[model samples]
Target: MGKYAHLNILLAEDDSSIRSAIKAMLFDLGIHKITEAADGEGALQNLIRTPQGYDLIICDWNMPNKNGLELLKDAKMRAPSTPFLMITGRADEESVMKALKSGVSGYLRKPFRMNQLESKIKVIADSWSEMA
Candidate 1:
């Protein structure tokens, strides 16, 4: 099992296929406990409902109700300790810079491999461990 197997993750994506794909990858990585949201608004609601907060949050860049960046900003206020990963097709420098500035734990370009996802999650886990 991976180090993050016990993590409780929240995945927000408007596209069903993309969301399913990521969920598969998360499962392959041994992340079994996952909560899914169709948009940033739903993600924020989930965050609000959970008192302890999720272990990690993964979101897509574009969505109908709200965008990933918006959720990230709001989540920071409510669950600052939660690690957030933004997965998006928007690889432009400006978008990447904005995500970083908004306190994203990791930013992933679309078409990412399972290893890439695992690596990013590992980095977050390692950093959190160091802090603890």
Candidate 2:
């Protein structure tokens, strides 16, 4: 956590396994300030309940309820400046464009490696400096 104390990432994945893996990555990066939600509805609840608690949110597209895109809209309403990273198993251009138009901070295809995660984080961190 000390290694990346500056980041507060949220893992909004329904699968406990994937969520755990993401959390583990954060732990490896020394980022212990991560929050988790089981579904889009749960993620919304977390956003409302813990406003400003998350600097970044990584969400899965498909879920039992609410879905990641819906959560993205809600999160944007709550924190327009907050960064959102969407993860989708469906790798179609339509879905990608829709998410981009909806204001995702980043998008990563499923079956992504930890290196991909790290690289995306670096890009986001670098871009954040230019944001007012």
Candidate 3:
């Protein structure tokens, strides 16, 4: 099993293809336990349902009914310890700074390589473990 196989991850993405690709990469990394939300509102609902919180949350920047930044802020307030990774096509400096300020654990620009995804996940997992 992979290092992250024990984790239960939540992914919020508006695009079905992008979400599937990310999920495939995560599975390749041995992360099989995953929950997906089509939009920010759905993500929030899932978060609320999971009181103990997810091990990690991967969200897109632009989503319907809440957007990634809004979800990030709300998620942080509800589950401060959970790690959040913002994945988006926008690589603007302003957005990146905003996500960081919003308490994101990591940010990944779209069209990211599989290696990059793995690296970010590892980094977040390590830091999150330390906090625990």
Reference-based lDDT, each prediction: 0.92, 0.86, 0.94
Residue 29's lDDT in candidate 1 = 90
TM-score of each: 0.96, 0.93, 0.98
Better of 1 and 3 by TM-score: 3
Winner on TM-score between 2 and 3 is: 3
**Per-prediction CA RMSD (Å):** 0.9, 1.4, 0.7
Error of 2 at 124 (Å): 1.2
Model 1 over residues 1-78: C-alpha lDDT tens digits? 877898999999999999999999999998999999999999999998988788899999899788999999999999
Rank by TM-score, descending? 3, 1, 2
Winning model by TM-score = 3
Over the stretch 1-132, how does candidate 3's per-residue lDDT look in tens digits?
A: 988899899999999999999999999999998999999999999999997789999999999999999999999899988999999988889988988998999999999989999999999999988888
Report residue 15 deviation for candidate 3 (angstroms).
0.3
Steric overlap count per candidate: 0, 1, 0
Candidate 2 local lDDT, 62-99, one digit each (tens): 97689999999998888988888999898899999999
Could you tell me the lDDT of residue 67 within candidate 3? 97
